[model samples]
Target: MWAARLAAPCLLLAAATAPLDARAAEESEAQPPAAEAPAWSGSLAAYLNLPRGNEAYVTGIAIANRGALHLEARSNYEGMDAYSFFVGYNLGVGEAVRLDFTPILGFVTGSTHSVVGGFEATLTGRYADAYIEFEYVPDAQPSGYAYAWSELAFRPVDWFRIGLAAQRTRVHDNGRNLQRGVFAQVKGKHVSGAVYWFNPASHEQVTVISVAISF
Candidate 1:
């Protein structure tokens, strides 16, 4: 009878202690470390280019986290001069997928009109010292047509970059057209300048030159 009593108390103690130990282990397993957030960056750029027959100039500014705001004034001496504003958001930084929106105002020789708005999506990839970006713009009226553009940029040295880009546009009613262009750029620590040839259409082209300083 005494031995039976001792065994019963010992079994009860083990059962209670097992549950407490399991609860402690489960508490430890539930806790984990927290994650960190990403940082933001800003940039300003100026450009000059000649697309088929006109001279164009632009000054662009960007203030962004993962998202960006772009504002620019574009002028073509032989054609229309436009002021453009846009918003661009990076879906993933240093990765594929980006989104853009642009609204434009254009004025020329004797007429004025709203250039409408445009939206775009882009994907990017890199290989060795060269990187390529693919962009798709959807169909929009008055100022935009559906288009795809591909660009490749190469870094000859740390602060100098050169690139070439090709674009094709499909109009809702007119027809299909193509543009081919080349660009050369030099970027310092806080400022950058670019020279380019922009052939926006098969028969229309512009040439432009510009300079910008940033803080």
Candidate 2:
């Protein structure tokens, strides 16, 4: 009789809380979805191009991203007095060895006018990163040409990186088709500066200093 009386209150307690637990479960299932990401973000990079025994030039690049949409503009990039604009979509995958890829189509105006199509990719890791971009000007003169730029870099500190850089560009008609060199960069919270010296041993060596800001 004593055991039966004690178990009677325990059974009543569980029976009374059962409706409360069911109500809590139903409320959780009706919760809203996650919030969206920011609407817009962008970065601006300006490079000062200085060549030995040649006139210096300024090249500026602007990139704007809205979610997966990517837009870019280049001033004095392909050649002196030239301009280019691109539109593309960004795709990415992985975490430990992440890769971001964007395939672009654009038009080149001003000095060199053509239809350009290309792709840009970057692979990132804990201490190493690699970036490459390739573009083909199908409508350029004299049967057209392809342009490429790449960097293989390693970070020694949180804010500094040393890298090997290579490019095949016709920005300057100096007969230096493939210029390879080394670069060093220092990064801050929202800004970065890089110095690249291409063909350090040749007479037509080029030095490119670039500054970039993100917002």
Candidate 3:
């Protein structure tokens, strides 16, 4: 009788704990794994543009972390003929999209100085990526100017991408110009490279090549 009584309690305790064990197993299977923390990242790039009559080179650097402040700078190689500095906040819209709003201060060494504001938004997915940017500068280049650029790219693999880009700029008294181009880019663990061919409606075509390093 004593053995039966002890067995009865043991069975009750087992019955009481079985549901909890089952629930814990179910919860474990249903819950997603924790995500790893993001780290700081940055890149530096050099660009060469070849036109019919003139060749120009530009160097740029940018640094940012996840959901943090971003800093960027760009200048031409010819005595920093054209230079720009940007300060911005980076925001992630979703898992695959990010937006940066920045204020830019720029100068052309002996020509003009201006203040501008801009935004760049990028969408990255498994097979493709797209980017758009807009900038407005008051009293720039002897007059006010606005610029917009958009690109859509497809990535066939992890490293290579091909894209089409369109860019437009409007300048006071200088008229508006539109350029369309195709670009190919390759990215590795720490190195990236791209080439672009741009054709303007009323001007000669231009070719640009760029290489970058990331840290």
Candidate 1 worst ten-residue window by lDDT: 103-112
Backbone clashes under 3 angstroms, per model = 19, 0, 0
Off by over 4 Å in 1: 1-40, 51-61, 66-88, 93-144, 147-150, 167-177, 198-205, 210-215
Which model, 1 or 2, shows the larger lDDT? Answer: 2
Candidate with maximal TM-score: 2
User: Each prediction's TM-score against the native?
Assistant: 0.44, 0.85, 0.67
lDDT of 1 by residue, 52-107 (tens): 43333343333443324333333321123423333444433343433233332222
Model 2 scores a TM of: 0.85
RMSD of each: 10.1, 5.4, 6.9
User: Model 2's lDDT to the true fold?
Assistant: 0.91
lDDT value, residue 7 of candidate 3: 100
Model 1 TM-score, 2 decimals: 0.44
lDDT of 1 at 47: 47
**Tens-digit per-residue lDDT, 41-141, candidate 2:** 88999999888888999989999998889999988867788899999999999999999999999999997899899999999999999999888987666
Looking at model 3, report the run of 10 residues with the lowest lDDT sum.
Answer: 169-178
The total number of steric clashes, by the backbone 3 Å criterion, in model 1 comes to 19
Show where candidate 2 strays beyond 4 Å.
1-29
- Roughly what TM-score does model 3 have, to 2 decimal places? 0.67
